[model samples]
Target: MSSNDYPLTTFLADHSIRPIFRLPVFEDWLFWLADRTGIQALFKCAPAHYSYSPGTIRRCTRHGIHFELDISTYHGWMIYYRRSGNRRVSDLVNRGDTVMDVGANIGEVTLLCAQKTGPDGLVIAFEPNPATFAQLSKMLALNPGLNCVLVNQALGSMTGPVTMVQPDNRNPGTCTIASSTTPGKALSANIPLTTLDQYIEEHPISRLNLIKLDVEGYELNVLQGAEKTISRYRPVLVIELVDSHQKRHGHSAADIVKFVLQHDYRVTDFSGQTPFGIHDHFEDCSLDITCVPNECVSR
Candidate 1:
């Protein structure tokens, strides 16, 4: 037997991909076969940078918004957002609406909401990582037309100094206030923390139309702290849930869904696929869920 026997599999096996192909799953078997058996080496054009720095500016072609990125890989990320749920934020936001973007992560989705909200509207964006916050500040500065107030702090159930851990240097967006028992979290910083309810009580937002949360695994805590605010405004909730991220905070998708249900809100997968009912089987909840108050939900 030689490479001519099975050129594709033999080449993939020689390059060590054969191990992945051998996984005990019919899906894996059909995956390589279902797709055309071909391989072409495309140019590796993605940028290589561990953190954002000055002099890096990207104008998103999709949304036409400028982003001074915190993560220097702007070329790839800017394109990635074109198809991701970031655009969904635009659908849920409206002109003159106020939005709170937790874990804004360099204002990726914040700018989109700002575009939908218009200049009269306001977007209060929060990012706890100091380095990332600096990039976000620069990006917002680049777009002065967008009315956004960037906050450099974590939103939780209380207001105090909180410890944030960066699980990976290459991935700054994964930083979270949740305790990381895993190793390689040598990078960390102490940042201020505040609750949405308390902040609104003092700052006094007359109308909050949306609250988009991407706080890694601290979504439940933020919700708890904003209970009063949610009850009052009942703004549309856009949340991103990752099982691994939540497990760090001792929570799960079900817990978050339960909280939303208890508050009389219904969950719709951001893509409008899954529906959360009283049955409450959230084991397969979508990564991004749009939560709407029962009163606001359309038939």
Candidate 2:
């Protein structure tokens, strides 16, 4: 079976050997084997592609964006999941609003934000992984109507070269600049990093309305780097905070919550007024937290 097959196809092919493996009275033995080795779960997590394979182009009806992805890999599964899921991010944005997508993997959400912002608005997307950035650039070509700027660099607390670790070569979403969370064995690369303050200084913007960040567990560093920008505009923030990832990266959920509180921003889910505390656990909080400044909440 080819590794380039769509996720569904690959799934069917991989499990095709199950019948042979469970011959006649060997069903119990098969079960025992699976239980002892954890073969079922690990199979999906394994490298999806062993060689270069072309990605399939698919349209996301929910957000009205097209993406090219190799469905056999984890990255493609995420794209599929994001496509079918509710578009809460789009709802938070408005026409003519300036938006930034930090850690814009493949530009799926960035395209959605661009559509919501319209031609009068601007969407700045940052993606540091070279392979993923190349794919994002290709996807952007299909949507020329969007007023967007693509930055091929990572954002952190400073402007310099940051080491990135990707345990899965085929899944660029797992590529992270946070060294503390890096797997014991992984491929490493040096990418350019810049602060949001430095970015604004170089290309000044009158206002920044919103920012959607999904940079693994390095959210604190990115936020620290954007202190000036956050203080000035107080843009609504959509950030993913995973306790496991945060711990690996030397940050905590409390740290993030405190930072938001100090900046006069309330951390809630996309549903208005539903504070994060309901699901907040210092040890296992893994959800997208929406931070809306008090000014916007009043309006």
Candidate 3:
């Protein structure tokens, strides 16, 4: 069976698999009992990401947005379980804005941005892995009339073809650009790689409002490629920086903070209320930060 067939999720969807632990009545009863006992908070702590069949699509009538969720994979399942399409994107994007989703897995953020941007706006989503790209394309097709474009190329500091390394199993979102010094198992090669600067120069946009990047760890390469564009447009950036992931590329959060400082930007939490700086803290942790321009944040 082809990877695009989405075998596991397809099977679950058709069979409606429910083991004893997943039986709704018993699970719901347990939750109710726990809530009554004031111990539900324990259940809430680091709750394992929930998974559903591949066919879960959520529609928000109030926001006039709807999109297919990639419930087959771990990250996709968690995002769908959270019901927040691409975290904080709903807050940053606005009507008629030009936005970019650098590592758009299954087009969750892409569709949300398209809905928020309305008919007059434009959203470009980039996903390099072919299997995941197929899923993203399928999601886009399921939700029509959205002003969005899908790119099957990886964005980085240079313009050339690069191999995409994807790990085995159900987690498709872990695909990343493979480096020479970095060892990997699965090999998906010959993917077209380009810089955001070059892409923008070729496909020019008058205004860029926001950029959402979740490239696993190669955030610096992407940011370097987008330096010219960010300097030119000064768009609000939402980037994910995981310490373990960054270590693979021989860098740290402090390195990213230095880049932010060079770009005249400040790092703030998702609420945008608390501003922080790069330091020895937050080591060995996954961090999601919003990089805003022209703000003087305490270092």
| Each candidate: RMSD | 8.7, 9.3, 8.5
Among these predictions, the greatest lDDT belongs to 2
| TM-score quality measure for candidate 3 | 0.78
lDDT of 3 by residue, 45-83 (tens): 222334445544433222444445544567554553343
lDDT per residue (tens digit) for residues 1-299 in model 2: 33334453245336444333223254345435445754443233222343224453334433577766665455564554342232568788899999999988887778888999999999999999887888789888877899899999999888888778876655778788847546834443568999999999999998899999888888888999999999999899998878777777888877787788788887886566677542455578777888988777765
Q: Relative to the unseen true structure, what is the C-alpha lDDT of residue 199 in candidate 1, on a scale of 0 to 100?
A: 85
The CA lDDT of each predicted structure is 0.73, 0.74, 0.73
Clashes found in each candidate (C-alpha, N, C closer than 3 A): 0, 0, 0
What is the model-wide C-alpha lDDT for candidate 2?
A: 0.74
In model 2, where do residues sit more than 4 Å from their true spots? 1-62, 80-86, 178-181, 184-188, 277-280
Candidate 3 segments exceeding 4 Å error? 1-18, 21-70, 83-87, 180-184, 278-282, 295-299
